[model samples]
Target: MKMKKLKYLSCCFAFGSLLLSPVFAQNPPESQADPQAQSSSSENSHPHGKAYRHKMAREMHEKMQRLMDKQDEELKKLANEMNKAPKDQKLDKVVTLLNTLVNQRIQMHEEMKAMHHKMMGNHKEHHE
Candidate 1:
């Protein structure tokens, strides 16, 4: 009786795998890849229409750059404030600010990884 039950469970599991395998084989889960290909494909496919190539686009790009510069300036100011955040301040608040700073750095690392991949591809294309 135990052998029959074990065999039934094994068959059921095998049947479930067979059903799921087709769906995954057609479209893989994102984890199975590093996702660089998907990002590259999607970026390329975005139309450089009027919105992307027009004067407004240029202005938008410039504005974004300016905003990034402003953010850097603000972060610098925050660093100065952090430097002066002394023993008198609540430790939890100081710790929270420091954690936020570290989190920003982690976000920057992800951006850098993507940028590095993009740059390397460009370099390879240029050489070719």
Candidate 2:
């Protein structure tokens, strides 16, 4: 059972890293010496100004951090409960917690996908 749990966690971590790699891999906008060039590049890349994008990015980062912290706390609590649970109840509790975590991850992924779609739509509109 412990081995199964460890394998499950390992798979989750690998999948999550794969999903988030692109977001982390993005390069920051380069500094352009020419103001006009910089402005044009910014406009072309993102309809919203650089400051607005920065603010949005910061807010999103904070939100993600908060969610992660909450998840961590919940996991810790669940772990404590599982530790104290009777052997007969441990399996059920473990299954429940696994379901909860998987559901949360799925929800988060869906929300991110929707947000990406919305952003892409806006980008298309701006370009058109």
Candidate 3:
């Protein structure tokens, strides 16, 4: 009976060790993991990455606002020139209006380029 009790005690001890070992497994000692890896891991993990994205978006938003302001100015100038153009000078008016159209097209193309650049930056961040 004493031998059986000894066996039971040893078994219980083994089981206890097995259960408690996981506590240590749950967290590594600070020195064990590479510091740079830890920092980079934290940076990519949800909150920090999300904050980075938000910051990028804010900057891009400001740039978009500036571009819009420029577009508005161009639009106002185009409108003014068209309004000032006379119907009596039809050929001259046509030429001026066509030139204005070309300028507006160029402005739109620049805006598109800016938008595309911002989109590429956003995509690169996502992949990283």
For candidate 1, the 10 contiguous residues with the lowest summed lDDT are 19-28
lDDT tens digits, residues 45-88, model 2? 77465666467657766877887788769867876786698866
Predicted candidate 1 versus true structure: per-residue lDDT over 1-128, tens digit per residue = 67755665564455445434532143435753554453454455556422333454366457556755765676677656755776444343344444555565556556545655664565345334
Candidate 3 structure quality by residue, lDDT tens digits, 81-103? 64586644433444444455457
Error of 1 at 99 (Å): 1.1
Which of 1 and 3 is the better model by TM-score?
Answer: 3
TM-score of each: 0.35, 0.59, 0.44
**Whose lDDT is higher: candidate 1's or candidate 3's?**
3
Cα error, candidate 3, residue 71 (Å): 1.9
Candidate 1 clashes between residue pairs 3 or more apart in a chain or in different chains:
none
Alpha-carbon runs more than 4 Å astray in model 1 = 1-89
TM-score (C-alpha) between model 1 and the true structure: 0.35
Candidate 3 Cα outliers beyond 4 Å, as residue runs: 1-47, 89-102, 110-128
lDDT of 2: 0.63
- Per TM-score, what order, best first? 2, 3, 1
